[model samples]
Target chain A: MSGAVLLSLAGCALALLGGLFASSPLSARRYRAAAALAAALIVGGVWWVADPRGDFGHPITAEAVDANGAPVSTVLVLQRDGGRRQVRRLPLRRPVDGAEYALWAALLLGLLGGGLQYRTRDVGPRWLAPALPAAGAGAAAVMFARMGGLESGEAGVRAWLARFEVGAVQSFTVPDLPWSAQPEGTVALGVAAAVAALALASALWTTPRSGGERLIPIGAALAAAAVIWRMIEVGGLPWRPAEGALWAVAGLLAVAGLERSSALRASTLVGAALALAAVALGA
Target chain B: MPRLPRMRGPWATAWAVVASPWTPWALGLWVAAGAALGLVSEPGQHPASGLVLQLPAALLVFALVARDLGASTARLRWAALYAAGLATALVGGWLAGGEAGMAEVGGARPTESYTRTIAGRSAAAHLGAQLGATLSADGAALTLAMKEHHVGEAVLPLDGVREAHIGRWALHLVDVAPGDEPAYARLKLTPRGGGDPIERAVRTGSGAALEDGTQIAVLRLSPDFGRALGPAAQIQVDWEGGSATAWHFVDSPDLDARVGAAPWAIELVEVATEPRLVLGVRRDGPIGVALAGFGVMIAALLGLVFAGRREGRS
Candidate 1:
């Protein structure tokens, strides 16, 4: 079996065992300690199996030449398990802009806030709670503006725009603000504004009941929207989600499910299942 | 306050250290120092070094949180799962070799095109040219076909020519002849305006400035003066306060090579290019494992939160 499939199978088994343990009413302290030890050992075993030195995957480098023996290309061949070989194309141009950095910052803030929320007592003053998410959303907005709106000069945006009824024009001209005319940009700006407004309101008016519970998911949703927009702008039409986007969605779903559900075990199972799906899709 | 029984041995010492109020602060400082060092250093030097430094801190924090929250076995199990997932992610990243690094395949040429391979995927540069590369099924062999000779193209907007009624003036490449120098391209330039069309023979790297302040210079001639591939010229048009370069391929006239942010569009047609396909792999870390770890962490954290809430209510 392929490494990803094998890992997934192992994950499924572990998750099932965890679920059974969670549901069982065994009250013996020794039994509980033994289960935890076994779990730790299982995790170590999985890691050992996945080690690169094992038979999972390895890298191979080779050079290619034309009929005249002139070097034309160099190729890096990776041998995956099950002897499956596939040729894939990577994008040559990777445009990094302020929006991408802003999204990353926002993701980090959301995660930090989530971690803080898990603490027994509040880590900081009350105002700091909402301010964190607010700052994240504000940063995203500022960066989006700095990037000359959503439709700056990316080819992906132009190609996506071409699909619309707006003739063969290279770009849409919005006299003063260039990004106002693009639908994606407008929606993204709206989402960012809304998230910021909500966070600000929470900060000034009322204390959040569940701390970062609502804020993290909303911030994640905003980040996810930006990631999806980036995917469209980079990959163009028939866009495929990149690995980063897949992980962002996985994290969002997992956190949201855990926060919303009452039963911890059921929520964990759902989160694990979603994570497995993300892995399968990303792989 | 009632005194508790004094504990001894290695396990007790470890517990005492973990329970110390200064422990989290010290670990936090260590994390901050590592992060600061990582930020000051150049990226890709040791991409995972920062993460590696923070791993021990994370483990300690996890332990402290578990003890503080009085987490049950199930919650501890989930936390272990989360740690395992994170370790797996770290291993995946270590295996992938961190960020992408470029390796020069061959020496530089007059014009070189590049191709990249990421995670077994390949893509050619957007040069309006083609480079063929293939990999064998056995993951053993790869073949690349390089073009020996190819045509080049370029386009120039007439409106930016500076001369009055220049928009009405049409410039055409009448002919390309061989010159004494291999790099020289002898070109016949015909400009049709209100008056009769003026025909002039312009050598490569040299062009005449019209009565207007407009200056045209032939920047480069691709594939030499006269070769199997049709002659391609890199032409620069400089007027009053602005300058633009365009490519003209004698073979392909329809190629739109206009790029950059300018009021008036200049079409740089096509040019001969010897493309070298260089494949580089950018490992964005083990995203799947990291994400799985994140999910497990969230699940474990939720369990702890629920437990804490229940204890508070009681």
Candidate 2:
């Protein structure tokens, strides 16, 4: 297994544990401590396993050439000294992998919702308050399903190449761009930061409500839609940071205004608009 | 009583101005104008010079957002809802039309998408170098593009191509049209000299004949089958039970034709996005951005309306 896979598994474990303990009858200090632990594990795990070159067997670099044995000018050869034992095959993994991003997304959403956890004035179902975070976590599975097995995409590419070559078989690794280099993740991150900063300023105009109960169904719906959109492969993951959060938060806020909906009309209109924007961006 | 004497300074004026909504509007207009000017300005010597323009756009957005920021319940919910709408529209529209989005490049037909394919074996070595330029789609047309300014274009009108591998990367244009069937297929030669790729009407009838001197690459099938056409012509690619895209490369413009050789065909496959959607998205991106911007502006307006109400009540 690639380190990315291991890291994601570890993150999932820690995050779940933190969520469980943070909401328990424990002291606020303990809750904060568990949350802190989860955050550290997630960050440390991603950093430790971030390198793609870490997966190769015994670092033997070879010259990449064409069928005619001519040197193509697109790439420059780089050598790295391998210090570890060789593995013949391994799973492709990345720290900024869709799955990892989904987990991180969950954490971010949880952080946003944590304000609901502070007891002081009054409280509604705190358990229900995790609706958005839970939805974010569920969205990861949808992303994985949408991305599909790495090999399947490679196979699709390979099959296409077979049409042109004389005796072509799989010769090189499929191009798996490094996580930091992927535009979607990078753009999403920047947008998320900007939006959150904006929210810190303007969100103060809003009020908090105890009706976390209503969000559960909406979150569930989002998770389902995420899977469907990924399955279609048109473009864009349903729960990407900027677009998904925008829609999710809007849905919650709109629903909050009616103390319910004026029916489901208001919520549906905003929800539909947000969904269109998200999907269209992927295209 | 103590503050009464100090309310006369420029500082007080500045405070009053800052608290007014007009401050945000003025700053917003200035920033918007800067962004528009940046778009019109000449490209800077250093690529980062263009950021001089973008900085103002960002500042405008920040100023507008932060100016109205508060901790009140009304502000938070309304703002979050509006901001969400704003973000979606902006990113989505940007993806469709702006520099950030796919730049639509197609010949006369003018589509949001053009099928991307790679041809020739030597294209891969410099795949990394050409990737940026290739992605720009500046020189992109109907044909598959290669490194440098070289282009490898094949016009297979009747026979649909499933995939193609240029030297750069694998690309597939899988159009698994409903009726998948394989019959006789042949592709003409474009002679690799940039004239026109050989053409063949995609026919799905059985029994194909391979004449001598037919230049064919039989990868899955045996080279011995090269000599005998009638019996060895049966080919099935894994993509479908048989081929729907069969072309008889008829007027061979002399492509690697070998003597005493039988011609057998291979299935075409590779990597690429859906051809139709690409064009549509590229075209629609800008429109989406504008519409989204308007939507967000409306929300902000509503927030203002609520703010006005709150002030009146207070």
Candidate 3:
């Protein structure tokens, strides 16, 4: 639901559409148009996610009341406000449903592979093309999974996430808020299952003849599998930007290299530049 | 036309120089230096300053990348990739580190952070009026800093206050008493930049006493709020105790303790140096220690990735 996620998905979709329509110049043009659309979606998503709206609320002061106008227990939500330090409370949403995430992730991978087929001159066979998209989507999903709902119910997740810690990254374990608890817990499990199912289905359905045909889709599927496993292994975890950047760079590199034509080459350049620019805005 | 390998022109030589593998090494060195400087610089100043530094670092990295990749690919691809990397680093850093100077205050410790809100105005109120000081591990020593000095009578509530030691020139602590007990414990410390208003306030033993010089006050808590200052003159006390303990250091030693009721069992002792106020809560809990440790790591990693990618790709 974040802009980065959406942009990444749109990128994959654009790439896939480009692949599907590779046979004709007209189709390639249409696919290129789709790529542009995907880029826009990504930018919009990034802008929205990095919203700077400030929410100011009254500070919580711990007050204890006795049985009859007497003090029983005292708690002070010591609010420290300085011109320098500003703390905001970001109520964590539930871990998105794992099933839904997997489904989307799979779709994204397929789209990425498809896009590569259209752009690349000889991407082997029809079946092999989905691999690139699979890789992109899988990698992105795995990375995305690392972040879902870690902030749910926690007061200081944002602050903590902003800074670096050693060892096991400790997320803020909040006294579970009512709204986020059930959905977060259930969605994670469901999404995990759904992704597993999607991966399995894609694996069974797609078949290609030559090694070149298998290369793109197989690589993509493998990437997706890696992502799925990472998500599950990390307990629906998220990746820090440092680590996540690797995937982004890799995705950019893979797509850029898949084609040699002036148009595909230009599209890759534009896409990569846009992605980088998007990264710079820190949206 | 001889067509001797395109005559091995100067263009090829220029391209080789520009896109040479050594570009990564040169870029790597610059990126490393920039990151090291950014981390080592004084906290709270680094975010903006570091950002400024990043431009040069990104450019260098991109330059090396463009040189190497552009020759193989078209001029446009080279330019595009370089631009992308630069943009990504900037956006990523901003998104992660916001403007509030959190990244500047980079290290984490298991201590509560405190800020004083001064209500009144005094001479120390103008430019160079603010003091930004930090305490050492002992919670007894301090790094005193003066900023934009101005004078004013300020109603400063020192949150996360644990203890205090006032210099003679500025302020002095009169007494610290437990909410449940009245016996006043006197903090002992040497006075600097001498003045007598603090001694007079201590001698009168009146909570209403106000010192003429800088006012400094230190507070104590019993893991709970037994007694604390309320709005205006009201003293709020909780029979059930549970407040985090720490101290606040002020410039003036004179404090208006009459804001609260008197406790019964407290002792007064005079020592050589004024007890320095421990500014933040001493938590040292798991989360605190972990966060500080990780903060440094994450920052370093971000620098490495941005620097490394451009070089590696090129």
Candidate 4:
């Protein structure tokens, strides 16, 4: 079987087992625990397997040639193969939107925060219940709107494969971003950072101290902020505050619901509602 | 002092009603039913756009009502809600669209003058052009032979067809190529009465039976098109001179989707063509949304598991 089919099968199986165990009585506590763990794994596994970048079905890749047996079309090109560094590009298609990457990362953080809050006896900052998701969604929207990928001018996947490159790493280089290297970009980024830091500081204030739990929300907050920064500053994305805020609303609702408590049932239900809302608005 | 029940008034009453085990299932069913309506008109189009809203609404109902359902029965009821929603959606998708797709839309129409070309000077361009052939279907594969002279015919099977058009192309009766018997077979054409066909053009990318440079057009049927046509069914082909020709078919449509629709790549090995549109499946959208949906479901299940774990612990 192809890797995707195997992954899908695994996901379906885990989901099924999880459902069954979820209803089992106290006598089957062991099975329930195992099922829950399996279900958790399914969430991550399915996401990875189904990602647009995952290229789930098509495994066959061939060069399109002309009548003279010369190559005509290609899809993907490897700019650098990693031992020290790796880079790949599709000349025709827009590079993977940085905003998309940010959105997924935010989701990861959301899941992480929810998991972390499970053991806490006391809730973290009441404000965090709303602020975190708002920030996350807003940042995502802003980043997405700014992406070069979404622009009409951006090329498709066919173009990306046109150029093929392979090279050994000579030296690692950090490409300068508009946000970091330029003054205007730096100021805007700094202001956004300050606003985020204030929100996070407030959230962390009331959080319980155990297993370094404080880092969870902070890390999540940072991830969201960083994604926004990367999109605008480095990717040279446009500014659209309203769109950003809308996504922020979605993010806020999502995180608030999921992070409210570690009680699996309640959180899941809440998470589902908020996440769906986010997708509806943003997608 | 004895503590009175910490809740009171209309708010408390609302909570009591929502806490009932059947509420989630009932609500979920309602959502599925409502969403299924959007898919009813045409399943072939895969039109599930309302899913974007319907899914959120169902989830929101659950979220709004989800409270401390401390007992086993309540948890079981919640699981039932998930099952019901899943079942309902599956049924909906199936009814609206065929199996894994959507739309009961329309039937296929005949195509005319579809061509793909490879611009190489000496590239082995293979093409298939057929006329007045009697087809025997072996589930998308056909044992086709010209009725008049038993000329160029091959068993075209699963994934062995490239571009198939249902319109006009003429048969060059005088042009004949002696093809290899086992692998490549020659076709000899004998026209009853027609001058539209150029009797010298050939497309031999893989093993087409006409001479090289014979500009020919043949009816390339859709996957299972021949099978769907039953034995000796007449197929229409518009001739180059505004005339129509009839070809016979055999068998039934292979219900298996792959048999009806082969991967486009499979046809490339057997047939080379001029530039033409190549269609393939390319799914684009946020898979993260699907993941999130599953995540929510699993998390709910985890809650049930935790409940069990806690009960066992206690």
Candidate 5:
């Protein structure tokens, strides 16, 4: 099948395995490690596939002609194919200001804080923790997906999907986006880098004798920063249906990690109810 | 503290180095090597947008070193070294020709008439027009024509269209271009059963059986006239009019998006007229911001993982 489907299946399998093996203490550590690693890889892989640097081709070119069969000039050159360059003029007359960058920044920061709180070792009944984010994220994702579905009729969805395809399959090029260019080894190299970073983290944790208390803040900051940067790069809302679903999953996992029986029971009931509600409402 | 017996030789030296809190420097060196490789590969040839991408490695290295070295003076040195590493990356990106200028190009509605012509034989031209003006053809080949230019269509002798891209948008021709049996198809654009033309036009569907050498009129309706025809709205039939039936009736919208209700609302009718096509420049906002957004998402995800693992350790 498609690489995306394959990768996603692999990730789901890993997450499942992690959850399954989490019954034993020794296996719990392995479970967490596998889950985290798999989730992280999926996240990275999706982003890479969606934004393949080398595959982003430009839209408008310099040699483009107008409707009346005249050459198109006075537009920004975005891509160059052979000798023809795709170009489009700047400063469209009317603009749609949907959401500002500042808003996105705020949302990302909030997600980071929420994630931190949910993952914090001591806060709340352990079982209640992950469910909080999971429920909230899931609710938000479902709502956003509805909106996106409505807009599926518009060209926006197709264009967005085009970016993903173009990034993956090298042959695809968006003639309208003339400036699109792909980054060569970013994917393979990025994955390798991630693995190395994970290894390094493992080494650090294993090497230390005890007392992880002091390192928590630094780790938190790194996580926050990384999440922020990644959110920015992904260029969509955290509540965007696809990526937002991942966050929801993260939330659920966080709650599950808390390990409190009543909280787990309550969360399970609430989650099941929510799933049922979704199904009923959808039907 | 009681002194333990001294461990000697290569393994001891290696352990000393590994535990020496100088691992950050080693990590930094390794990071540099990775960056070097990334530069060499330069898969997509995307010029660097900003210093965002390199932050994860820097943060990871700095946090690791700072945690291992404690809050001592040595940690301060590591911080400075981390900054140096970042600076080196920025410089490397610059050397590799990554950064490009970001010019602001505001968004515009696709409600205006737009025309794009592709020159050279076997060349395809895509013009971003109002979504309303988009039409479908159900013949062996699909051809679109500009008012002034010759009406030409792709002469592919294929029956079914595997896929299609109109301007930046992908569309399904199955809706407008009937089943495989039709020899020719015509998409009409005139408003039906006139309301005040100033108000919304009741655009009902009208079909013209297309035969060889069949000519159709492409109407360039006004914004007021176009807005009346909403999504899936089509004209019922062509209205035979008075003296104004002359060429002057065809309206070309102003390119400025603000000047009209919608910039690309000029409709394409299926009847032949002196003024057949309304051609003009169709503009949309520059895509740099969107590109930047995609970049930000990627960098953030990577950073999150790095931070998550690093924090777990600390």
Candidate 6:
């Protein structure tokens, strides 16, 4: 591992250890203060190590080869940044190749630490409860928007060709299936929209005094179900869920299941564990 | 106390210990350790490859954690039911194996036309006068030769052609040829920040390494490429951290064929038609068990929520 990766791992470890120490019953005022210092160090370390600007401006070339390693189609991707290029490839395969494990580990550890710290400090302002759900809804909305409309792969290609008098008289006829029949991104879009709306509703109603507090768990459960459904829908052949999708569904379900009885901090720990298992299995 | 409950068995005692409050913390540590070890030992390999042995134990630990977190007996029962359903689905699917899901079973041969419309013209004409186009495979490129009744023929390279504006319409290149061949290509590499253009003429199975450490190789070359019958070349370019193989056509100069983000803009200036075979693919899987499990899990969780509400009211 590079120094940056090592630094990142160190920061994550320190954050987790500090957060756990602060949250423990044996922690004193001084220990909590020390933990706070450690948190600051972690933030600084992350800021220093993480590449915020990212690997941009580089050209990317993608080639699809047949079984014999013959080039079927080679695409030269220019002008677009690396991040955008990866997003375009999301539908086909894993966007990140190596070091994905480290990235995920850092993310999980950071979240675990933050959750522990947040619990020790008590639930923040009333508005904070809705913040995460609203962000999730926003993210879902963005994903839906990015995916655009679902198109029949062959039909779309043929339509373009027909204008050129190509494929105009072909004997091959692909049934113009209805929108519901197009499973590509249609199911994912529908589920995303549904979950987004539910999350928005939960964000709006989850408050200490609000009678709609139950909406939190309800929204979480529905999101989990929607994610799981999308996984099954998109998983080709053997029906294996994508690693990212598995982690998401596991975390959402753990939250929905444990949020009623356990404190948010405890639930975070459980969710993290389940998320780990989900990611490992999918990997 | 009235013959007190008979001393519990060894298994019962062990179960009690396993379900104790401290068990979750211990399990959490164990999971963390496992994850850390996996990360350190084998970074990129699938976790299941190395950690499959620990899955059952991990599941048991998860159950303990759930119980310790105060999940009710009813909720636990529901979770157990869902797990059983999932297990049944997996087992049954394994036993009845032969690809249970939907898949594209057939394809059709479609008559495709390639035509160009002149600007400000209402009529669109095919490149060939007789409306006949023949697609021939030469190496890695597919050459589309349109037969013109009036004069010379219009030969278009279909392989490695990205965007070709024939009149007002822009046609994108789709699929190329199958298999590999040595490329015979002429390349132009322009440095991103403006430097001397490096030009090289490479034939099939040969390569040239630049001073800047960029390796260019002619990986595949079409037969009759010099004669311009769908002349094309597949060039492989490798830099420090990345490599890309781009298809180049002799006819189309506007084709942007570069792979990956490299410092140099490598252009391959080197290098078809048929009724496109359109495949109608339908994909299906043995998802019945999984779906059932999901439904059960969701229903059970919702039931738990409602039950809690009812209990609160009482």
Best by TM-score: 6
Q: Model 2, range A1-283, lDDT digits (tens) per residue? A: 1222122222222222222332223222222222322232222222222222322122112122233322211111112244321211112222234444554665566454434433332244433433433344345434533442222245533433453442322132343331111212222222222222222222222233322223322332232233222312322211122222232222322222222212222222222222222222221
For A1-283, candidate 4 gives per-residue lDDT tens digits of 1222122222222222232223223212222222222222222222332243443332212222233322332212122343222222111223333433544554444344334333333246444432443354345435533442211111322233223233342222111111110101112222222223332333344323222212222222332332233232211111112112222222222232223233243223222322222222121
What tens-digit string does per-residue lDDT give for candidate 5 at A133-207?
A: 233333323332222221112243234344332322211112232221122212332232232233223322333
Q: Which ten residues in a row have the lowest lDDT in candidate 1 chain A?
A: A234-243
What TM-score quantifies how close candidate 2 is to the native fold?
A: 0.26
Q: Model 2: DockQ against the native? A: 0.01
Worst 10 residues of 4 chain B by lDDT: B98-107
Supply the DockQ value of model 4.
0.01
- Native contact fraction of candidate 2? 0.00
Candidate 6 per-residue lDDT, tens place, A5-121, comes to: 222222222222322232323222122222222222222222222222222222211222233333222122112332221100001111112222322333333333334334445
User: Which consecutive 10 residues in model 5 chain A have the weakest lDDT in total?
Assistant: A91-100
* Best prediction by DockQ: 6
| Superposed model 5: Cα runs more than 4 Å off | A1-6, A12-16, A23-121, A148-283, B1-45, B49-245, B248-314
lDDT of 2 at A118: 35
Off-target runs (Cα >4 Å) in candidate 3 are A1-93, A103-107, A110-261, A276-283, B1-11, B16-314
Residue A55 accuracy (lDDT) in model 4: 31
Candidate 2 local lDDT, residue B246: 26
TM-score winner between candidates 5 and 6: 6
DockQ for every model comes to 0.02, 0.01, 0.01, 0.01, 0.03, 0.07
Show the lowest summed lDDT stretch of 10 residues, model 3 chain B.
B100-109
TM-score of chain A of each: 0.30, 0.28, 0.27, 0.29, 0.27, 0.27
lDDT of 3 by residue, B1-314 (tens): 11213426897776566455444334433433333333223222333433434554455444445443434334334334434544454444443322211100111111112322223211111112222332223322232223443232211123211222222112111111112222122332223333322231121122322232222232331221222221111111222232122231121233323221222111122111222232221111112222232233233323333433454467
Q: How well does candidate 4 score on lDDT at residue B190?
A: 28
Tell me the deviation in Å of residue A51 in model 2.
20
| Model 2 score (lDDT) | 0.30
Model 4 residue B72 lDDT score: 49
Cα-based lDDT at residue A18, candidate 3: 32
lDDT of 6 by residue, B127-183 (tens): 322222234453211222333423222333443222222222222223332313333
Candidates 1 and 6 compared: the better one by lDDT is: 6
